[model samples]
Target: MATINPVKFIQQVRAEVSKVVWPTRREVLLTTVMVFIMAALAAAFFAVVDLLIRTGLSGIYGIFG
Candidate 1:
């Protein structure tokens, strides 16, 4: 196994990072909006699931009552 020097490793990392394609501001905003939309959808799904579970448990209690 070859041992790496920290300074050389950091330089190599920086060189690779320079080659990355960064997103534009508008694209970032659009992605952020989509992320929020997805999060909202997930929350809504869990809310429906929670309501169904609560309703079912209440129905079981009603039977015992």
Candidate 2:
């Protein structure tokens, strides 16, 4: 592989960084809030599923034991 010069590499990195479309503060906040909401919903869903499974297993074991 060919080695890139340090100065050229730094210039290329800066050029790429400048081309990025960074999110605005409002957009960032909205996305963060959405993420939190989705995470909470997922946690609740898993908790309910876990409770159902545990109850089902307990009932089965109770009948057999």
Per-residue accuracy of model 2 over 1-65 as CA lDDT, tens digit each? 99879999999999999999999999999999999999999999999999999999999999998
Model 1, 2-62: lDDT tens digits are: 9999999999999999999999999999999999999999999999999999999999999
Per-residue error for 53 in candidate 1, Å, reads 0.7
User: Cα deviation in Å at residue 1, candidate 1?
Assistant: 9.0
TM-score of 2: 0.87
Worst 10 residues of 1 by lDDT: 56-65
Provide the lDDT at 48 for model 2.
100
State residue 42's C-alpha deviation in candidate 2, in Å.
0.8
- In model 2, how large is the Cα lDDT of residue 35? 100
Candidate with the greatest TM-score versus the true structure: 2
Global lDDT of each model? 0.99, 0.99
In order of appearance, the predictions have TM-scores of: 0.76, 0.87
Give the residue spans of candidate 1 off by over 4 A.
Answer: 1-11
- Global lDDT for candidate 2? 0.99
